[model samples]
Target: IADQDEHCKKFMEALIPEAFRKLQCSHPIDHWAGWL
Candidate 1:
């Protein structure tokens, strides 16, 4: 249905930015930094 499509779109738009910020803050390199 069109309503489901619209809702999914809105949910993704809301989620992507927060996911991006968390991805940015999550530093994988920091884990290796301690070994060096």
Candidate 2:
């Protein structure tokens, strides 16, 4: 449904950034700008 799609979109918007930050912190190497 449209509501589910909206919810998934928001959830991903929320999670992806934090996850990417954690990933960058965990691995401090080349291409770290992906976190920002």
Error of 1 at 2 (Å): 0.4
Instruction: Score candidate 2 by TM-score against the native.
Output: 0.72
Q: Clashing residue pairs, candidate 1?
A: none
> Which parts of model 1 are misplaced by more than 4 Å?
28-36
Q: Report how far off residue 14 is in candidate 2 (Å).
A: 0.2
TM-score for all predictions?
0.71, 0.72
Q: How accurate is candidate 2 locally (lDDT)?
A: 0.88
Output the worst ten-in-a-row residue range by lDDT, candidate 2.
27-36
lDDT of 1: 0.88
Candidate 2's residue-wise lDDT over 1-36, tens digit each? 999999999999999999999987778754565766
Q: What is the lDDT of residue 12 in candidate 1?
A: 100
Task: List per-prediction Cα lDDT, in the order shown.
Answer: 0.88, 0.88
lDDT of 1 by residue, 1-36 (tens): 999999999999999999998877776667677788
Clashes of each: 0, 0
